[model samples]
Target: MAKFPKNFLWGGATSANQIEGTFLEQGKGWSTADIDKFIPKEQRKSGPADNLVKRADVEFAMHDKKGIYPKRNGIDFYHHYKEDIALLAEAGFKMFRISISWPRIFPNGDDKEPNEEGLRFYDKVFDECRKKKIEPLVTLSHFEMPLNLVLKQNGWLSRKTVDDFVHYADVVFNRYKNKVRYWITFNEINVLEMSGFTSGGILADNIANRKEARYQAAHHQFVASALAVKKCHEIIPNASIGAMIARFESYPKTCNPKDALANVRANQNNLFFSDVQIRGYYPSYIKRFFKDNDIHLKINDGDKKILREGTADFLAFSYYSSMVAISPDATEGEKLTSGNLKLSFQNPYLRSNDWGWQFDPIGLRIALNELYDRYQVPLFVVENGLGAKDKLSKDNRIHDDYRIDYLKQHIEQIGEAYQDGVEIMGYLIWGCIDLVSASSCEMSKRYGIVYVDLDDYGKGTLKRKKKDSYYWYKKVVESNGLIL
Candidate 1:
């Protein structure tokens, strides 16, 4: 049996938009995430909002050029941050992973100077974390891209966006150079391949030449990420820069070689993005797939060098489920693909979240071993949790044994991987509090160890209540692992 280092980090993770509700406060400009709440839930193809967005209206006329109705306010995280952070601190989180909203810093996307007001917002948050002695792991871009840039430049489709993104990174790195350290250039670099909204902040349903656009967009992000890493090291010499990938551990349906082949293909599709970020070039399989699909990326010579020179210091992955890849067979009753996986309910044995993410703890060990073997870089479990529905008892306590079970089993696997010689930094649970869900925007699919009472219908108190998992997690962090 092996043990994690005594100083190994244990904590929770969240994005700015999902948790920081002061969407348009303190002179903050409207980000792409802010506009998303105004859009209808079903129209949110990538990640639909549950109940928060619908009841978010607070009656203020925007007086747009088209004279449209004003948008609603978010959960008001700006003011409630102190309360929330205290809860996380009480839960024994040694590290807190959060993204800094770029629009808040540079309102119109490209700016000669960052807003002092916006910079101060993060300073306060960081100061609070420092007070609690919690290490801050910041992601430069995590789903929240400036709206003006996305609409004007088609997000990463234009090369100029890459340069602009690097500028944003430079500004942030310089601002927090001495204080906050761990940096992730881009969150889930491959998400842009699947969902343009997530990848590029684009909401348009009509995407002209989507495959070409996705690859091109991804190409720009890869370059931007590399540039950010290079600039961050310059600003902060000892920065441990990493690239976060949304790793969905895939499995074959059966022992058949054909079924296993499908799983390999699925894994390749997911890994195509990481291969470039970590390996510094496109994989042969991806190149061939692009050729067959007529998807071409415009990469300059400088971009190649940037990628090669600034590879990720570590790999951060968000593991939610283990998807079974099934081969198309006339005899096999059914199969699961991206489109049909939600409706098919293919696997009955595995447990699923309210958002339909399969809960698999063994998948963590499998993913860690695979990643360690391939990249040989230290692995960080950036995001992993079970999104469930929790009810507060009359005694004002929320009992979330489900969340406890979910994280405990996952943490057990982390220990197992350590025994297997996989170098791991820490485990950051998805949401420390009930924040917006990435898949289904509904707050009902809550992931936080601390339960926020406010619901979709807007009836309950906006109080921070500790769930059973809170105490369980506190013990895990104090014990350094699940000794109990």
Candidate 2:
């Protein structure tokens, strides 16, 4: 019955930009997330092809009136914080995973002073969470940068961005030191390597040699993350700061060693982010990777010391599903499949959602066991959920048994992983309430157990209602995960 810890945290997670609307209110300035426009099916060049953001798109989004920018006016969590927290608490949630918008505090990312109104807003949020006995798992940055930084500083591509981020981290760490205890330095830090503009705001098309810019920006982030960890420890004194990444663990396409080797290298490419944050140094494999790829990163003075000394206290990751890896030489006529952030050969044995995200709940157990064995630190499943379309019946109810099944199966794998001796921290389902989709920028790809009556075009009553999964999750959390 003790499959999960007595103190196991059962909760739902959402980033500020994803859930909070009123992007410019409370003294909050615009951020990178504010610029993401929803692309209709007809307009999409390909599946997530618009992932590579360009400077022109950024420029257009700033002034474009016709585009449907959902993030700018998310589910309105900005004004509904109390009500939303109440709903989550009513479902017996012990934790509420949320992120503080960096631009909200420092409008320009390098502002000499923080916007007091922005800090005051989260004060009420944390207070409500405290009143409801819901712990706040705060992420420092979640795919958001100040628009000013993107335009002027080139996001994380400039080392100066590191100092700006550290100062912002320090401000929040000191301000929320008492209100919040859990911290994640960056959400999906590895995304910078591939989706530079989205993750780091480098404006992908402007870079001539993208590989060099990506790593150089990644190096800056590595230093900033480490420095943030160090500052968190110095200021919070009792808080646990960790690193977060988009965890993509894949299998080889065939029994061939070539496929296996390709899979190993690909996994390392993703794991390299956490290695620097958790292990406090670069893996030996990365030296060959940089040299072979002709990517040179500028590592300045004392950066290594900061990394070595400021290792994360834990590892947080998002694992929605696993992919199959095949050697480039073996790509004869194999069908390719889309995944979280990578493409690979689709596995015939797996079933996919409407978004083509293959489901392998059993893969969750395998991933947890591997991560625990590798790092031996407490691991948190910060983001894992099925994004499927939900229907609202006329009775003012949403019978989303599909979502209940998705969560139940994944929770089962988590239990198996716990029995296998993984030091599990907790599980937080992504998008606990329906909000803008991070990849496609659509609200229809709902992942929440609680339904938000908003559509892709941002038309809705804006009312919140519980889905069938909500009561199901209440029982699971009430029993400390034993009921499931």
TM for candidate 2 is: 0.98
- Per-model CA lDDT versus the true structure: 0.76, 0.89
What would the per-residue lDDT of candidate 2 be over residues 323-413, giving only the tens digit for each residue?
8888989888988777786666789999888877888899999999999999999999999998988888899688988788888899999
Q: lDDT of model 1 at residue 154? A: 67
TM-score of 1: 0.90
Model 1, poorest ten-residue lDDT window? 51-60
Q: Using Cα atoms with residue i matched to residue i, what is each candidate's TM-score against the true structure?
A: 0.90, 0.98
- Model 2: pairs clashing at backbone N, Cα or C within 3 Å: none
Clashing pairs in 1: 48-441, 50-441, 50-442
Model 2, residue 364: distance off in Å is: 0.8
lDDT of 1 by residue, 137-218 (tens): 9998887787667667767778999878988888888889888889898888777767776567543544556778878888
